[model samples]
Target: MSRLTRRRALRTLAVPALAAALALPLLAPPAQAQAGRNVRLLVGFPAGGGSDVIARLLAEKLKDELGGANVIVENKPGAGGQLAAQALKSAPADGSTFFVTHDHTVSILPLVVKTPGFDTAHDFVPVAGFATFANAWAVSGGTPAKSMAEYVAWVKNAGGGKGAVGIPAPASVPEFLVRLVAEKYKLDLVAAPYRGSAPMMADMLGNQIGAGLGSVPDFIDNHRHGKLRVVAVMGDKRQAQLPDVPTLAELGLPGFEDLPFYGVFAPAGTPRPVTDAFSAALAKVVALPDVKERLTAMGLSVGHVPGAQFGAKERAYSAAWAKVIKASGFVPQ
Candidate 1:
């Protein structure tokens, strides 16, 4: 064929090729296309802890809600979620990685740690706040104390007014509470810090530690089984799951009126639409009857707050803790 004829034939084939390429994206189904795509839900506590259990539950439900995305929970336990927060900071903000944590890592840590490595305001974007919960002061089988007063009395009698109280992590709200408890009772009480709630609970169950302060979810099962005794709880009101337990405010230890929160956050710079999608999916998941029932049984007041509104709540909660930390004269470590 002549050069002109060959050129004309090539142009005809190129037109069809370009049209087919343009139609490819439209032909793919959003859900099916994401079938093998992996989405990681990161928890900063060891397996069997409250945070880890919640993450696993969410991951199971989120797989279906997030358009067939293969959601998985990854535990990056250390430094009371410091390592996980740092990991989230370095993760790509393409909706692939998210941190599932409680107020301790986000609100309390920043107020207590000298340099937590990741800034909550600058390093992360709040995806959603799922629930709020109380923290409880519980006595292990090792102690004869049934209530806070008895616990105080027991501390006074034991070893000449010196005892150790176990806290899930160092420089956390429970540690601060331990200090306040010591001051209130005028005892030389030491706060023992553990990597996460699971190990702390292990020690408490084994009677290696006399007492501990942690989330209601952390102690609810054990308390119900008579493994431990929950004496005083934080927040303004008594927990529904443990109604017989008295609030700290009623016991004259009134600083922790604000309840702790549970939330999911993505790395900073994640697109708003991406976060919004996650928030919506989480809301739906939290609304499920079984999911809500499970969380409630675990000691959480299950509710879903959207991303932007949740972020505002987070800031307000952080600010409130800041005042309490200042009043306690806690130097950021």
Candidate 2:
């Protein structure tokens, strides 16, 4: 063959090859795009709070589990975790980010807020669960009430006015519980919502509020130290950490029995492989004996519900809370 003809044939083949190379970038897969990328773990509460602690704990180990990927925790900290959830919605779904939060942010918030920034069911993918947390109602150490029955009698008197109770956030499960308690026991109790459990707890310690409601983990240490008294916990049975504390059902309020959940989530459409990888790594971390001991020490249980089951769990939680919120006639603030 002539040299010029051969050269023309090679140039013709090169045209299609160059075109195909240009198209490759558009078809890039999530796995290659996410390889060795920095991961952002988010918490919707202050740095010292339990949510933040859990996120940081999982973040440190997850980094090693994910093959030494750079992982960092960012605290968004407002609106009862609404800000962090919305921020997660705005992130790229490439699998480098996740939010560690409780049922309030995922299942309860959307039911209370009329126009929440994102849909709980569609905006994020539930990746993994840490545990179910039982909310507890407690009184200040000096309040002269050590048991649920005594606490009810104390609230009934309450200086001849409605007793004030500190709740962690407005429109939260605890806030609704205040109403439920009011209706069931025929006691006048006012709900005072605060930024978070820590601040509300400060007032409880100062004796500014007779009683407070929050997650048992938030109250257990103080309760154990004699700074506060947990009267009743909101679950079917007493927690191992607070075995002496009566369950709500044990106190005759059968409706306030469901324990709230805690879990992590990635933005919607995040690659399944990426979420599954995180779930697998987390199972290992949660199974560690130290992890279980520490979690139980803080009033948490070691219940690891994986991605799909967790999503279903979150939905069922939402359905139940919707009825409670509606029945309470709470107007979101």
Task: Give the Cα lDDT of each candidate.
Answer: 0.90, 0.83
lDDT of 2 by residue, 102-208 (tens): 99888888888888799978899999997888999999986898897788888767556478889888888998888888877887889898877777888899998
Model 2 TM-score (2 dp): 0.87
* Candidate 2 weakest ten by summed lDDT: 25-34
- Give all TM-scores, in the order shown: 0.90, 0.87
- For candidate 1, which ten residues in a row score worst on lDDT? 25-34
For candidate 1, lDDT tens digit of each residue in 254-277? 878888999999999987767777
RMSD per model, one decimal: 5.2, 4.7
